[model samples]
Structures are given as structure tokens and as C-alpha cells.
Target chain A: MMGLHKKDLNLLLIVMVLALFAPFILNPFPTDSALAQFNAGYPDLMQRFVIFGIFAVGFNILFGLTGYLSFGHAAFLGIGSYSCVWMFKLLSYNVVPGILLSVVMAGIFSVAIGFISLRRSGIYFSILTLAFAQMSFAIAYSVLSNPAFNLTNGETGLQVYASDPQWLQSASAPNAPHLFGLPMRATETLTVGGWDFQFNVGYYMCAIIMILAFYLSIRIFRSPFGLMLRAVKSNQQRMIYTGLNTKPYTLAAFIISGMYAGLAGGLLSAMDPLAGAERMQWTASGEVVLMTILGGAGTLIGPVLGAGFIKYFENIFSKINDNILHQWFSALPDGLEDFLITIVHPFIGKGWHLTLGLMFMMVVIFLPGGLVEGGQRIGAMFKRKPKDTNGGLSAPATPAE
Target chain B: MGILEVKNVNKRFGGLQALGDVNLDIQENTVHAIIGPNGAGKSTLLNCLIGKLEPDTGSVTFDGQPVLGLKPHQINQLGISRVFQTPEIFSDLSVLENVLIPCFAKRDGSFRMNAIGTVGNETDVMSTAEKMLDDVNMLDKKDVLSGALSRGDKRRLEMAMCLVQEPKLLLLDEPTAGMARADTNNTIELLKEIKASRDITMVIIEHDMHVVFSLAQRITVLAQGRPLVEDTPEKIKGHPKVKEAYLGETAA
Candidate 1:
């Protein structure tokens, strides 16, 4: 409907619906219920779900379409966050300027990084990106946060302090990060029986932006440029021989994805008004890769699903402490309960990374095309999931290959 | 005077003279065949023409313009298209997409940020690509992944990809290299049809004399990095140097 093919339109609609109604979809359990801890509807976690979804969606444009994996994508995200926080410090907590600057700054940095990194492809490209990300992390963590010129504020992170010159901020305007007059932290709680559903302004803002980002990605996936990106991934030799330049195409995709990552980073600080050097850490970069791969790297909706999946595990699974585990297994015999907790202990709570790692391995090994392929398989089992009418052809193929 | 001129092009690899003082004149609207035994510098000469390799000395020009330092894509943008020896079609793409890429490249320059418009919306380009596929007898298989196609189909798809661009010069490097007899005959017929249907110049490099005789109007036989003979296909059939270039290798 939105200049997309019917199939893409349907996919976009599904994502929009899911994002818009995420609070209800995520909060199935009542507040008093034993499963309430699993509820991911809280604004903090919900905002993260969409923000990282934007990040992975953008990452997929580079890694998924052109098959250029940048191991240091989080540098752009960190740049976005820092730019956003700088806006809050200098201007106001209005968020519009911060987000815009974040995207621009990320684009500029990506042009520099991508220009150099794209010189080599395959594992070399990946290693180059990794090196750049590490350097950026080091610079942001220590160099930029020096006492004489405190930008990132070292490990303390950059936040909107009251003493900071917020020249654009009005006396009546909300002091916290906000859109116009609406505070990002503003929330409405709907109580029904033992269920409490949160409707947070910040989460909605992120959700709306994520939906737009997703729509743009869909348009890109359907476009001629998207086809060329796929062609670049398939056979660069053929592309060059066919009179198509590969450099500008790859560079554009890199910058575009960088801007997307920056937008995501800007959203991160817009919600909390805190910019940490840790956001640029290699692990954060790896997390987006995990999200893209775990969900399905190239698929239109796969990255978002992967982002939500990993964030859910990171937040909800990590919250399951020893007491929560003991309470769940209390009905069992004392010895057996203790044994179960011991076995499960290393895979949950503080060790939730173990569970995530196992799940990632299973996805890679079993569903090599990621979760999207798994969905397509199930859809095919019922009937040949009507093949995508246009550029969505990348879905049915094995992504790992 | 011809459309493409190669003048004293010399390319050396350490002690080996890959292509030494190679000279050729390829005319427009003709199928010119370049036949040589292995390591006779036929591929090297072709590489020089396509910008894959730069000759150490001398100039290669297409349509009176110097093409010596141009990039591969730049060479292509100047209306020179090459079909590789091993059918280098986009394996992951559909047959239609394989042709569509060159069409986009032909219409748009070397680099275009056409990120906003849908490919499906490009009705003119789509029709052109489909027409090329139809000419190659691959319209029915346009949706089929180019990788999964039979050898003959891949060859034809590659042909479609090149022909869709409608380049002034089409370079074919061993177009029927490893094909079975039936597939070879089909490719020959396809080439004949393509030649008859358009105002295109084709320069084919081949070891197969049957293909060389069937399609080439003019022939150039090379031996030891130099052109031994340039004649019509009939005269080339009985040329003594051409015989020595082929039969001498076996006798030695």
C-alpha cells in the first residue's frame, strides 16, 4: 500500500501492529501472577526492544544485503548517543535536534570508517571494522572524557546536569528528555483486575520511530538499489563487469546503516538522557549481530524479531534470581528442587548469557537462515508459503551459505 | 580503421612476455574470432581490451577513445561487455534479475542511488529485461534461480545479461568451453540468432574450430603472443601459420 508490493505491505502492517500493541502483547501475565516477572511491558525494557530493533534492522542493510559484516557497528551507535547527549547539554532535552544530530554524526563517521573498511571484503573487512570499533571505544572511554574536555564523562556517562547550559529550555518545559512538552518518562498505567499495563510516552516515541525505520527498510528492500545491493552480495565481479560501480553502492549502504544505528543510539539517550562509552563496546556491536543472525539476517522482519528475542532474554531471563528459581521449584521435594536449581542456575539470572549462547548455536545449526527461515519452513509445511512476489527472494535462501 | 584498435600492446609477467606487441583491428557489425593454443596470449589480449589487465606499453582504444587506464565498469560503460569463460551470471539471483542488472547499469550510469523507487515500478526496464530473456529463450525460466539452471541455460542467461545492455562490442571468452555437443550446438545457434537480430559486434576467443567456423566472419590466429594471421574465416581455415600454431604443439 505504501509503494510496497502486496507481500511487503503485509509484512510492514504486521510489524506496525506488533510495535503499536507491544504493551498488550508483552504483558500477558497479571501483576500478582507467578509469571509476572516474565512480562516485558515495562517502558525501560520495551524501549530497548525497539531501539535495538532499529539498530539490527539497519545492520541487516549492510551485512544482510551486501554481505559486508562490520564488526564495529556499535561505534556509530555510540556516536549517535554522544551526539544526542551533547544536544541535551547545549540546547534542550527536546530530543528532535539530538536525534537529528545523532544520525548526521553517525553518517559522517561511517563514511570515514566504511571508506577505509570497504577496501577489503570478507574476513578482512570484518577485522578492520573490529579494529575501528575498539579504537572508538578507547577514545570515547578515556580520551574524550578527560577533565579538561569532559565529553563522555569517562565511566560516569554523559547526562543532562542542572548546571549545564540548556539555552533552549523554557522554565515551564519538562527538565527531563521530552518531545515538545511531553516528558519521555511520562506513563499511564491501566489497571484491570490484577493486571497493570504500562503506556509510556518514551516507549511510544521509540516505537513510532522504529516503525518508520522499519518502513524505510522495507522500501529499500523493494527498490532497485536494494536489488543492486543483493547483486553486490551475490557477485561483485559480475556487478563491475556489468558496468555498475561497487564502491559507491557499498559506501552508501554503510552510511545508510550507520545513520540507522545512530538513530537508534539517539533514541537510547532520548529515553534515559545518558550516553555511556559502553554503548560503543565491541560486545554491544556483537549483540546487534546476534540479533540479526538469531532472528534472520536478511529477512525484512527478522532483525526486529531477533532484537526483541535477545533483549527479552537479556532482561527477563537475567532477572530470574536464585530466590525466584527456589520459589518456582518450592512445590518439589527439597533435594530434587535443589538439584534442578543447580542444573538451571548456570543458564539463567547472572548466567543468562549461557542460555542465550546455546539458543544462538541452535538457531545457527538448525535454522541456518535464522528464525525467518524457520517461520518460512513452518509456512511451507502447511502450503508453499506463496513465494515473495519481488525482491523478498533473499528470504528462502540459507543465509549462512 | 576499425571500431576497436590494439596497437603494440605489450604485457610482461617477470621473464614471460604474456602479450608482446599485440595488435588487432576489430570492426563494427562483425563477428571476429581470435583462436590460439593455450598460453598464446589470447586471454591476456582480451584482458587488456576489458581493462582487467593493463599492457605495459602501447594503447588499446574503442571507438577512437583511449581505454588503457579505464576501470572494468568504465570499460563496460563505454559499450564493451564481456561474457566470462565460465558463465559468470549472478548465481543467487533469478534469471530475470541477472538481465535486469545490466539494463539498470545501461540506463543509470556506473553509480546511482536509486533507493527510493521500487524495481517493479520500472516498467520500461522490466520490459526490456523480459524481452532480452525471451530472445535468449529463458522467459519461461526467468523466475528460476540462475544458479540452478542447466549449463546451457546459464550460458544463455549470461548472454541475455550482456545483450540486454546492447553493448557496441560483445567479448565472448570460450562461450562453449565445456559444453556437451548438443549444448554447444544450441549455443552456436543462439549466437547466430543474436548476431542476426542486432547491430552488435562480437569478438569470440575459442579453441573449438567448429564454433570459430560457424560464427566468425573474420578471424585472427595468434601464436606466441603475436598475431599470426588476420583473414576471413575461409582463408583462416587453410592458413599455414594457423595449422603450425595448432598441429605443431602436438608434434612437439
Candidate 2:
């Protein structure tokens, strides 16, 4: 009996159109131009856009709706990646089974972790999740990766070995994870005039999955279950008195989000065909948290935008080296150019994290609703009249619907 | 037996006895008001009925089912809903949403994964929530954020939230506690309207003599955590012990 509301349907349609034409939209710079380096139409970064979008969207379900900020979601992402790789090594090169197995494995992990962590709420809940993730990271980093065990393949990361069974495919089929005979790494570059756009198989696959994830998230946001989650955030004590058991609802959300991380991990390995223990690190968890917070925690489109913003900044800003700075400065007067380069030096190249931290601080301070709120403010400027008088509270949108 | 029965219910915090052998039998379909001074264990007894606290050694039953050891949600499921002194509506949700939550609790039980079903698409839920809001005269503010409403309106929304579940016994811990006189009178009128229409029994813990006189059929006066008298409102109005218990509160 459930269907999308008109507004929700419109949102889904808009996202779909944008994703379908992303190759053209993202490759605005011509191939001959110096700005082409900033063009993000390639397979690797494009795949990352949708994959991390999944990760952020899932994290939003737990943190945004429940107000239970988890600090260890990346453990699920790592477990997902490892599960996908083990599937490749044991089952076949087909991606369908890998994604399914990874989700199941992550669900199993989340059940164990969520069961223990959900015993507490607030900062205590966050700390319990952090402790669990740190433990997962430690085990994956050393104990599981040791030669005696070698479950994670240690510092070298995990990849499909030629010696493995790969029961569904012959050893000669291909080393990379694929969908039937279709290679996930395949891409076609289209050149018109001076513009070059990449149409990637893996990127499209990730885009489809991200779209599905977004749709499901939209449903959850509008569903009675999502209402309960917002209730948990708004007032847990009231909910208990209302006769709603919050623990199971929260655990279900945690598991669903964990599965989303698993799906993202599966997509990542499908494209790159590798898994590393570094994916389980606390910083990785922090990155997804940053994505959700930076986009707008509870909004449906906020997490995707946050993921794209962080990944795009990481890719484009980090590529600006000293040589490139000097070239730009050569056009300016000698002294001023040198001064500008020196000032901008720490925020680019290897210092993208410094830039990221500053942006996060500024966003947290001025635009606490993240990019979505910033977009709303700029949008309200054109409209010139306040849409609703009661948006004065910290809640920017109505639980994202 | 009355709908709610509390027999020799005792609760202690360390050496201080919060309630010592409290006994009360609240009749069905009647407005019962428990009037006492501050620290008379009114809220403590309310907590015991709602499963927020367990009595040290006694039985509290609602409709023949024991309620002392049940969890808060389970007690709620047992058809006992309490409205807090301060308005406890979901601040972040819209007014309609605040009402619809209890509708879900009534229809779907404690927990059900109705995640894929759009709230707008659920016609029965929408109508039930709409009717409840209309009853509270909050239909105009259905789309407004609950936290943005004034204190009086928040109290109305809280009442709507409780009423939507159609609980058998409604425990109100000073429903009109901090309201202005006009708002307090309005709340009394609302209570009278609800009492006339619904098949419900209300146990209101109140300090305001005006509200107690306006709505209560039977009154229980407690002083120092012990019941001083149980009688009709007219009799209790002239009782010496009841006057002394209140005079002490004013003098202190």
C-alpha cells in the first residue's frame, strides 16, 4: 500500500536524471584545457562517488534519524570488502553473489556489534561503537592478517589468487570481479570536438545501486519506522511511555545501514577488485561521518552530496602540486604570486585534510545543516520570502521528506 | 474491583520511605483525582502504576492484570498511558506526526516494520490522526512543528497523542501545572468534554484546587505519603485533615 508521495517521487526523478547525465555534467572542461585535471568523468572517481554515497546514506539512517551517532561504521565497510573478496576467492568472479554474501556477512557482524553497543545510548553508545570498531581494526590489522591466519591478506591487501577454486568460472575467465561476461572495469571514452567523456560500465552499475539505495532510504524516511526513529531522536523517554520498544527499532536501523556499507564495499571491490585493512580504520569511519554531517544529516540527498563534495575535493584539490602553483603564479607579479602560493600551499596537495578540516569547521559554525542548508539559504534568497515560519529550530527539513 | 487497584504498595529510596503501604481502588469510568501537597508520593504512586518504578513489596493491578514489574512500554500496551507534567511531545516532528505515532501504536502494536509504507498513503491512519487532532482543536496546527507551539498548545498536542491510543486509564501528573489561569480553565473544559464522550477513567494528580473541584468525582487526599481520606469531593472539601495538609504546604 506504500508509494512515494509526489514530492518524494519528484526528488527521485531529479536524482535519476542527474545521475544518468553525470558523465556529461562532470566533464565540463575540455580535454585540451588545463582544467581537465579537475574533470571527474572517469570510471575510478565516478564509481567512488556512488559507492561512498551509499556509505553516507546508510550512516544517515542511524545517526540522523536516531540521534545515535556511531563512530565505528567503517568496520562494516571493511567487513563488507573482505566478504566480497572471500566470495571471489571461494565462489566465482560474478559480482551478484559477492554483493549478497558481503551484505549477509556485514549483517551478521552488525547483529553482534549492535547487540552489545545498543545497551547504551548518547555518547556512551558512540564510545561503545568506537571501541568495537577499534577492536575490529586491530584484529584485521595484525591478528587476522598474520601468515599463520592471513584472512585479510595483511599489508598487501586481498585479491583473487590464481590458485583459488573460483567454482563458477575457469581460472582463465578473468582475475577481476565481473557480472557474468561483462567486465566491471570496462569503459568507453567518447571524444567530440575538444571534449572527452568517459562512459563506464562500473560507474553505471554503481549508479543503479545508489539509485536503489536512495529510493529505499526515501521510503524509510517517510515510513512509520522512520517516524519511530525520529521519535527516538526527538524523545526516547516519550516513546517508551508511548509503548514503542526502541532497542529493536534502533538495532534494525543499525543492521540496515551496516548492510548498506556492505553493498558499498561490494561495489568498491567490483570496480577495484581489492580489499585492505585500512578500510576498517577509525579515520575511514570518521570520513563517512563527515560526509553525513557535511551534507545535512537527515536530508535524503544530503549524504550523497556530502560524499561527492569530499571525494571531489580530495581528488581535484590534492592534485594541485608546487609546479602547478608556480605556473599560475608566473602570470601574477613575482612577489605577490610567491606570497599567494605560500599561503595556499598548506591547504592543497598533501594538505587536503587541512582544507577539509577548515571547511568542516566553517560549515559546522555557519551552516550547521551542511550543504543542504547552504543550498536552502541561497535558494531562499531568490524567493525573498520565508517559506515556513517554524523552520527556526535546528531541524532544517522534516526528517528529510 | 475498580479498574486500577493499588494494595499495600510500598517503595523506598535508601532509608527514606517514599510510599509506605499505599492502598487505592480507582473505580471504572469515573474521574478520580489524587490531591496532595509536594512530596506526598503522588508522582511516585503514578510511576508505580505506569511501571516506571517497582514497589518494594506490593501489588498494582490494572484491569485484573498485575503491572508492577512490567516495562514502561509493556505497561503502555496494557492500556495505561501517562501524560507528563511537562509537555513531552516529539519536538522535532510535526503536530500530525506526534498524533499519528500513537495511532501506529494502537493499530500496529508496539513494533512493526512499516518502513516502505508512505504515511500519506495510509488513509485510515491519516483519518484517525486527523479526527484526534480535530478533537483537540489542533487540526490547524497539524503541519506545524510541535516544539514551535506555545506551552498550552503543546499540552493539547500531548493530550491528543495520549487520547489517540484510546488507553483505558489515563494518568495525568499535573496536566495544568504551569499554565496561566485561562489555559488551566481551558484544560479543565477539555477534560470535561473528554470525560463526557469517551469510555475512559482518569486519575489526575493535581495541586490546583480549582481543577480538582471542576472535574473530579471521587477524591483521595494523601499527606506525608499516606492516604488521609477517600471520599466524594464535597466531603473532602470540608475535611480538617485535608485542610491541615494543604495549610502546611502554604505555610511552609
Local error of candidate 1 at residue A95 (angstroms):
0.8
TM-score of chain B of 1: 0.97
lDDT of 1 at B225: 92
Q: Tens-digit lDDT track for model 2 on B75-188?
A: 999898888999998999989899989999889988998888888778999999999999889887788878888898898899889988999999999999888999999999
For candidate 2, the docking band is medium
Per-residue lDDT over B114-196 for candidate 1, one digit per residue giving the tens place of the 0 to 100 score: 99999889999999999888877778777767787778888888888998898999999999999888999999999999999
lDDT of each: 0.92, 0.89
What lDDT tens digits, residue by residue, belong to model 1 across residues A1-401? 77987778888889999999999999999999999999999999999999999999999999999999999999999999999999999999899999999999999999999999999999999999999999999999999888799878989998888899999999998989999999999999999888899999999999999999999998888788999999999999999999999999999999999999999999999998999999999999999999999999888899999999999999988999989989999999999999999999998888999999999999999998899889978877999656665454333222222
Mark the 10 consecutive residues where model 2 chain B has the least summed lDDT.
B243-252
Q: Which 10 consecutive residues of model 2 chain A have the lowest summed lDDT?
A: A388-397
Q: DockQ of every model listed?
A: 0.62, 0.63
lDDT of 1 at A23: 90
